[model samples]
Target: MHRRSAVTVAVAAALALLVATLTVLTGAYEITPGGVVSTLFGGGSGTDRFIVWEQRLPRAVAALLVGVALGGCGAVFQSVARNPLGSPDIVGFTTGAASGGLVMILVVGSAGSQSVLVGTVAGGALAAVTVVLFTLRRGLGGDRLVLSGIAVGAMLAALNDYLISRAPIEAAETAKAWQYGSLNAIGWRPVVPLAVSLALAVPVTLALARSLRALELGDDAAAGIGLGVTATRVTALAVGVFLAGAAIATAGPIGFLALAAPQLAGRLSRAPGIALGPSMAVGALLLAVADLLAQRLLSPFQIPVGLLTAAVGGAYLVWLLTRAPRREGARGAR
Candidate 1:
């Protein structure tokens, strides 16, 4: 990694730690930073330990991991599509996962987290297959993949709305809450699995980063250099799908982290192509900050973190769109 990129990762990691500390200390019981550190290392009071371990720490960890997962996957998606708008949120994987969870919640009425998880994973896999099937003949690159994903995502989104509308009011309420995507209900059960999944997937993503970069030189040039264009692209896509799927299953599809994290990371690092490590770090920081704000923004009320991300993400999308023409013009002038 470049010195600047490494520095970006370090700064993001430091900020994420600071925000997580704040999150652990911000509850009504009010523990000191020292208390939090002490509690983490098994030296604090029982109540302090309970609050930190049982409540706040899990939530904080969830935010960080989900951010990492989304950001890494977002970077992969953009690299594969060769477009900044190619995040999972745009491509439909998130909506598909949400649809699965909604199906379990509304139709099957499965209250168990395992059932919801299975539904989400299955839903996400289905969406990936749908998009790939559409673009298989043309291959997974450039505008084709992005367009197929958009179409799949839109149809799935409509299906989600229909499922919610047809369900009972109580079920509909539950589904709606899940759709908004909050880290509020997160605990060790979910966080542990998410962490494990990322632990496995992150290395695979980083391993593929070199090939993905070469792919930017176009399929013909990549093949000329002995790169297996189709296989590498598919593998990268699968890894991206897994990362996004795992995150959506764990966190209920938090909006725009997958969309914005990689873009922000690229700008911050100023490195060629998507930097997965920096993107993951940036993602972790972004979510930690968002969760902190969500908790403190309403004080005792404590709104969902998803709403905050969506509001910010919407603005980022607009900025990206307006900036694109200018970027293209600059390239033309050069």
Candidate 2:
């Protein structure tokens, strides 16, 4: 709770709120400003009620919560790995989860179902196991794990595309929407499981933040200080895998939020290392805005929010690579 961290949280909260408000106000079926307020409080025309309560409100809430989960886990992975590049996307969890959900969507033909969620989490777990098996050949090092994840992720990406190509035309189109990280088909029904999962995961991650700090001192130092290095790492890996799986299950691989949120949060909060609170808030802010942009950019034709974030993240990646100190490359790649 540094003052800078507090300030960053407040600012991100404000931006998230503003984005939510704008999202409600903007859409295909326009509702007047006063109408939106009245509708929110249980008094408006049927159209306004349906659009606001039944539609936009749930979508906005889902986006916010998903961002929170992604952002929180992003901080966990980055801090645990001791490098900013140590995110779920880079670690292969996202690709695994996506591959699972894609299979459900294409082969099983369940786009947004509880079964699809199960498949995703299961796929992600398997992918995580595979990466760990490969990396654990020598020892559990973040660099080795990341390298394994990248390779696994590339293979999974191909699998995902192949599945899509083999799908029926209609199913292909349906899976295509999910693949883009679009929230077009989401409703309040699916939000329950997602919200519940995030609620369960958040407190655990927050509790582990202190252990993460100690672990940042390296395994020997952490163990000397009486922290259970193995258990801590295992718990963190579980948390990151679960978070990334839930996110992918809900939104289908919304890239770069995991990659960018923690680093940006660290800079904004002026944290000694990485901070989870600011990262969650920043993630909510980024997603809220991205979802808004996704709706507005194509107007009648909504683009996927993932596309927008990927574009933004790509630019940020370029800046990061260019601005990073040369010596850090060896350390980061490790």
Candidate 3:
């Protein structure tokens, strides 16, 4: 890696540490870093043990894993689609995942991990297919693909809201939380699948790193260089969709991290190509910080982490639109 990439990674690692420390030490049961360390190694009081092992530790790990997945997925999508706005949330994948989870919650009356996983995967796959079909005619230009995704996403959003409105009061309440995205009640059990997925996906993403680089060059250029444009795009999209769906399975539609992380990392690293590694690190950092804020900012009445992300992401989106240079092309209908 270049020195700049190395430095960016180091900075992100440091930030992750700081956020992790803060997250562990700032809760109602505030424990020292030393105490947290000792407890993990089996040398603390029962209360400390319970707080760290049973509660905070799992939550912290979940934040890290979720952040990494969202960051990686977001970076991949942005790179493949060649559009800053091409994220799971923008393209309907997150909404689809949320819709799937809601279906399980409302129709099946099941909220188990497996149910959530299945629903999210199904919904995300459906959205991915819709996006691919809509954009395929012109072979995935940035603006065309983004507009198609937006249309599909809006339709899914409307469907999700309608379903939520029709559900029973209790189901509505449950679906409401899923819509906003929360990490509450998550434990080690669900972490296993997340870890397994990450382990499976990261190496593949890294291996495709060079292909992604070639992809940054337009399709014709990429093909000239012996890269299978269609295959590369499909592989990247699959990885992104799977990661996003898994994330939704674990923690509803946590929006914006996927969109903002790569942009933030790009700004931070100032690298030639998209900063995938740094973005993943920054994404993990962002989610960790957001989760920390969600835990403490509202205190006893904890808000969903997605709400915090949405607030930050919405502001960032406004800034991007204002600052981004306008292009004269066939603009899609709003």
Candidate 4:
């Protein structure tokens, strides 16, 4: 299993690197691989500088960062929930962040991009807390928690629809592409906020990982082994929500990477539970590749990255659903 995981991690890293390279080279105004390398070192032609530095680089960075964030957040959520299905995308976290982003885009039209990110953070955190409060009766890591998240997410999605409907056309127009999660209009400015968010969330999550492993043994066993079950759960949830929200802030809640990446990583690595590092690598690869496709799939008429992810992820979700029961039955037999 260890050897398998190592190979999986290596392959995932290679894939991410390849996808990043290809995304940098692709667009309506395509740059050669040689040109992309030169542009990164500040030696490309003026057109390359404007398109590569000002346009594609930041978008690519945002896609990569958001993917990492979602991947890490998904692993944490799945661990906390003790279910493979527990992901920010399937739960309320993404919707909460989206709702907050929509409000910022529509209601606070005058506020800057910074405000939009803040709103996303607030929305995601609030939604996570709300889900916790409602499901605490049954406790975390239960089917009840998953169902509650689905419920809350549905409600927030409805609110998002209503908000979009009531907003001015201009504001709604801006929100429309965001609603589907696009990396079309990114820049260095947006990258700064997301960087800050990741810096804050990632280290904290890593520190809690040992505790998370302990908690997987169950509260009684974990506490007996010196883990602060309640505190660990809270910390994990906070970090997970923060990462998910920040990703949404940067890229408008691109879904399924969070839902799918960790599970895929776990399977590939033969992890008994979700593996964070491998998951992040897979997610970065997935979104970067997805973004690359989003730009070139329709060529000059680019579609939203979120739209493509949604279609693909919806199909993945269906597959997971059908596959889950058989896996569970096998485990039961074991």
Would you list the clashing residue pairs of candidate 4? 81-141
Better of 1 and 2 by lDDT: 1
lDDT of 1 by residue, 99-126 (tens): 8888888888885666777788788888
Decoy 3 TM-score against native: 0.93
lDDT of 2 by residue, 1-334 (tens): 7789889999998899899888987788867888899889998988889889888998898788888888988898887767677788888888898899988888877766577778888888888889878977654556787788889989999999999999989899878888788776578877888899888988898889889888888889899999998788778888888888888777778998888988898988997756888999999999998998889888878888899989999888788878768657778988
Per-candidate TM-scores read 0.94, 0.94, 0.93, 0.94
Model 4 misses residue 86 by how many Å?
Answer: 1.0
lDDT of 4 by residue, 1-334 (tens): 2577678878987887778767778778877878888888999889999998888888888888888898899999999999878898877888998999888888877436688888988899999999999888767776777889999999999999999999888888778878788898689887898898888888887777678878888889999988878788888998898898788878887988898888888888886544777787788888988998998888898889999999999999999999999998999999
Best lDDT among the predictions, by candidate number: 1
Residue pair clashes in candidate 3: none
Say which prediction, candidate 1 or candidate 4, comes out ahead on lDDT.
Answer: 1
Off by over 4 Å in 1: 41-47
Rank order (by lDDT, best first): 1, 3, 4, 2
**lDDT, candidate 2, residue 97?**
87
The sequence of per-residue lDDT tens digits that candidate 3 reaches over residues 151-253 is 9999999999999999999889988987898887678877778888889988887677789888897888999989999988988888888889888888889
